[model samples]
Target chain A: MRKTQPYAFIMPSLLLTLALGVYPILWALRYMFYDYPGYGSATYVGLDNFARLMRDAEYWNSVKNTFIYAGGKLVLTLPLSLILAVILNKAFRGRQLLRAIYFLPTIISASVMSIVFFIIFNAYNGMANQFLMKYHLISSPINWLGADYAMLTTILIAVWGGVGNYMLLFLAGLQGIPNDLYEAASLDGANAAQKLFKITIPMLGPVLQMIVMYAITVALKGYESIMVFTGGGPYGKTDVMYLYVFKQFFPISADTASMQRFGYGSAVGFASAIIVGVVTALYFYFSRKMDKIY
Target chain B: MTSAKILTLVPRTILWLFLLLTAFLMLFPVALTVLGSFKTNLEVTVGATILPKVWQFGNYSTAWKAANFSRFTWNSTFVSAATTVGTLLVTTMAAYAVDRANFFGKRFYVVLQASMLFISIGAVVLRPQFDMMIGLGLQKSLWGVIIILISAHASIFFMLIGFFRGIPRDLDEAALIDGCNFYSVFWRIVLPLLRPALAVCGLFVFRGAWNEYILPLVFTMTRPELQTLTVGLAGLRYSIGSASETQLMLAGACLSILPMLVVYIFANKSFMQVSAGAVKG
Candidate 1:
């Protein structure tokens, strides 16, 4: 009875987690081997979906785009966030005000921000192009979401919105460091750059490692921004792997060529999940190896 | 001035300038939105200006009716509230049990719950999710939306576990000695102490459920009546025929975001706490 009491307390969560969390992966894995349109009965086609995933140019393009998009987000966000964290860590007038204002975007809903960006980047009357043209930066209005710049636009929007939280995280990590370490380093005639490289970076190793895993995973699995902003448009030039799988299931547009490839989509989804898992694992493994002996 | 003073002053000026620029950039869009919300459609679409010539506050009423936000806001509130309450109740109970009691499979449950924080096999599971819900005849139900919102939320449990651990066990023992069973001790003693944690958890979960789009979208696809605010906004047609309705879309967007902004302003301190490693804000 005593042993069972704990189980009783956790029973609801356990059941819900299994039903929603674990079951979906298993069911989707099973679905991956079959060809089912949304309504029709699924037909088993073992390994065919996987084979087609390899051969699918569009799928591969999506994979490439996912990496580029995720990579771009990481490249733009993490370093800038780190810099903001460092700057915000210092004592200054209006520090709290600046911090709060910068944090404003992170609290706002992503859909709201996406809509806001959409208006700002509107083809006919975008503030970005208008400002650029006003400054004689361009001859005419450039389509920010055109194929040439869609992914870049998506990446910029992501960086704009996501930098705040990561900055906060870094700020937390920075605050956790004992002040004595910096003071001790300064006693040894260390300059600001040396103190940063030698003491601060070394002390922040574990946090940095954790943040890398988080940043990479977040960037890799990002779907919401793309879904709202571009919808993987301009002939799928801005398409990412996550959206590829989603479009497979939901069919966002009227185009129905790949609408019925439910099994193939499931295969893509599972495959991408696996790839992400492997990448996350590899990151952990290598980061752990070089995790700073100090 | 001395060169030393000049050097320090230059960097200080540059830093302040940089900070102010970023602040302006951050606030600029919001300023435009707030200003543009009161603009006519032609002004919003055709001209790019910071302020409207004729402030049309009616845009709010028009957009509110156009999107039928009153109904969708109700949907968002009901579903999000239920999910937040359920999540808090369930996770708090689980955390209380794990913190206070000895039990079989406890280790497995804790580890499994924490693992969800990182490894999410996302996007691949939507159809299976749909199939499962549809089979249970829950695809069109508001409860379906609520349940889906409540499910797969181990992160809250993870956060609450910390809160529970911070609680002294002596409190539980004292309550237990006062003619209280384990359940009473939890309900009467521990649950009260968990209020701050609950507020953080509730705020986090409420914000998430309120803003959630795709899951609710897919689950309630068949039942337009059950659509949440985010999905409702997505489905709403801002214009009827040839009229460019940027104002309405902007208005609706502002309306959709108003609740969150209001919540954030009130909970600003809690949000800051959450940001600084309290709940991974």
Candidate 2:
């Protein structure tokens, strides 16, 4: 009874993980080599999918755009969140309220928030343009969602939505740093910048590494807001890897002529996963090497 | 002394000013959405004002009807509640067994879950996942989504295991010595002690299920009636024809945010602590 009891308890979750989590991945791997449209039997066209993937311009374009989007978001978000964390970590009035307010965006649905941003950044009369024109910040409203600025606009929204969560993480990292280090630095006549650069950031190394790793994976994976905002439009300027994978699987609009190419999509999906994996592995490798230097 | 005073005060004042400016930026969009929800569609489109000329509380009702929000709300609540309950049940049971008994393949199971947590396949496998649901004859039901959400419980399992280890085995042993079976020991004894851990995990699971977009979006594509609030709200983007229905969309956005806001208000402390705990784990 005791021996069988353990299996009884663990079986439900294990089986669930296997069926939903593991099975789909294996299914995708198998489908990668086939040429199955959703309705037909999959035909094994060995190495054809890989060869097509190599020649696919759109897939590689999305890969380039993914790096740009992720890179732009991280560049802006990390420093902004760090600064906010340092400020909020101080002893001040309404500190908790401030932290909560910043963290508020993180809780809201990304799609819903992006819709609101869509309104705010509307080309004609969006509050962003209105306010800017009202203040004479610009003579005319710029088309924020145009091809010239769509990626930039998306990055700004991403930063706005993401900064708070990372700030909270940074705040947690800040809290772990002992105060005596700052006090000792003060005894040596260290100024605010010196103390921050020399002591606080060094102490935050481990937490920072973890948060960066987390942020990288999330930024790469995130396409919810973009999907709602642009539908990978304006000549597919803002198309990321996952969004492209999604479009391949399910056409957003009825007019899509070449939708539901399951076999090729599975191949694309596999390639996307490998790219993400390789990037993650490279991050781990580089971060480890930096650890040795430090 | 006067020059020194000016130097110290200057930076401090600038710092406070900058912080307040950031706070304003953070609150602006949400404030605009809420206020816009009450304005007329023409007023919203004009962007000529900050406040509504006359508060149109009727927009909420209009939005509700137009978006089929009542059904979506129910669907969201049902899925989130069921996912949380199911996840808590299976994860807790698994955590207990793994923490207590030395079962065969136990190490392998733990390692598998850990690797699953690290190796995310993202949206790549959505096709196969949908196909698997069709295979199970559950492609038309919300149960497919609930099951998938519950299965992605690697983090929750690890969290519960950590919580489980902190709980002394002496209590379980005492219950067992009292002629209680393993199930009873779990049900009557340890389950009661796991309330704190359960609450945190429950909140997280509920929030994830509630705010989830992609899975529900894909699964409910064929059955529009099964769409959760997030999916339904996103569908409202252009569904009301060429006019865009900005006011209605704002009203719906506000409505979708309410349940999550209520949860956040009630458990504000736990929410902050969870973010902090994430890094440590």
Identify the leading candidate in terms of DockQ.
Answer: 2
What is candidate 2's lDDT per residue for A15-92, written digit by digit as tens?
Answer: 998988888788878988999888868899998998999998988988999999999999999998998898888888
- Per-residue lDDT of model 1, residues A1-294, tens digit only: 556777878999999888888888777788889887767688998899999988999989889999999889998898878878888988888888888877878776677677768878877777677667767889889899998989899998898888878888888888877999888887888876787777766777888788878889988988886787778887888888888888888876543364656777778888898889999998898888447646
TM-score of each: 0.95, 0.96
The digit string of per-residue lDDT tens for model 1 on B36-148 reads 88998878766656789999999888867765777788898998899999998888888888889988788999888877666665666776777777789887678877887
C-alpha DockQ of every model: 0.61, 0.70
Question: Highest TM-score among the candidates is held by which one?
Answer: 2
**Candidate 1 — number of clashing residue pairs?**
0
Instruction: Give chain A TM for each model in order.
Output: 0.94, 0.95
Reference-based TM-score, model 1: 0.95
The segments of candidate 2 whose C-alpha lies over 4 angstroms from its true place after superposition are: A254-257, A289-294, B174-181, B242-244
- Expressed as tens digits, the lDDT of each residue in B21-56 for candidate 2 is 888988889999999999998888775689999999
